[model samples]
Target: MSSEVGTEALTRRGLMLVLSSPSGAGKTTISRALLKEEDNLVMSVSATTRPRRPGEEDGKDYFFVEPVDFNLMINRDELLEHAKVFNHYYGTPRAPVETALSEGRDILFDIDWQGTQQLAQKAGDDLVSIFILPPSTAALEKRLKTRAQDSAEVIAQRMSKASEEISHWREYDYVVVNEDVDHCLAEVKAILKAERLRTRRRAGLIDFVNRLREGY
Candidate 1:
């Protein structure tokens, strides 16, 4: 009698996680912290019509495109999700994200609530969303001013928008109160770990379980 041993293989699958927050809510800081700590995670590069910031790379920080190209992409249905922020259009391209997921790589998204809603419609199963909130509106305003990057007028506008942004917190799958960066990072780590172990993420779990039952 010939018998074959059932080989157990570890396969990776992709995840689409979004981290959204109002200005000065620490979403970008948390995202950087996550990337530094999580070796296997990558940030999704969004395409934008805005000019590149100093020291920002073309593809790393964002896929900088002209207004014409961005409008063309919208017409072609190439964006998975997109939004207009401060009069500039920004969007996540469909092709790169699809390719990354198919190849078993996890992608991180830093977008607003509008984009998150659109993303969920397109990638419901693979999507996990987290929204960050400042300890208080006053604290949020303080943080935004600490950076001193924007003019007083612009800061006022952002402060106004913050209220609207925070109103959508219930729409996210997870809501994180970023009172302390270290503590919040720990919370995010736990969230990711738990989500990674979800049954749906294990595409081969059923077959693997069957093999064990059969003693193969």
Candidate 2:
């Protein structure tokens, strides 16, 4: 039993794990933590038409492109999911993602609910989406204020928009209230482990079972 236990890992197809949440709900914090701890899990860098900011790298931070090139990629079906935000287009390129999936390397998407929906339409079988929620509106507001990056007006605006974002919680496969960052991260990690073990994602599962049935 000791020798056979955890001897071999199964060959599995990868999944697209999406994390979405309202502002100040701790999704970004959770995402950073996951990337730090999870093996074979990497962030999905998006191609963007937005101008590169200072200290941002090309292809590393974002695949910065011109508006025309971005349109061309969309027309050519080179993007798995794409969306316009603040007059700029951002998209996940199809090629690298497909390659990663086939090689059983998971991709993490820190996208909004709308982008998650777009990914669902194109890759539902490979997608696992989670929505993070704050324990209460008051707590969420408190978090936004604590950040100190926003003025009173901006914080108020973010709170208003958070209401709309929170309404889409039902569309996610899993929802976790981020009252505590450590607890919330653990919940998400559990979800990931279960999803990775799913039969459909295990590429050689059928062969492995058949060998056992043959008494090998």
What lDDT score is found at residue 21 in candidate 2? 94
Which tens-of-lDDT digit does each residue in 75-168 have in candidate 1?
Answer: 9999999888789999999999998887667899988888899999988888999999899888898899998888999999889888899999
Off by over 4 Å in 2: 1-9
TM-score of every candidate: 0.87, 0.92
Instruction: List the candidate 1 regions with Cα displacement exceeding 4 Å.
Output: 1-8, 51-55, 149-152
lDDT of 2 by residue, 1-216 (tens): 122213234778999999999998988899999999999899998999999999999978999999999999999999988998899999999888999999898999998888988899988799999999999999999989998978889998999899988999999999999989999999999999999999899865666666566664
Residue 99 local lDDT, model 2: 90
Clashing residue pairs in candidate 2 are none
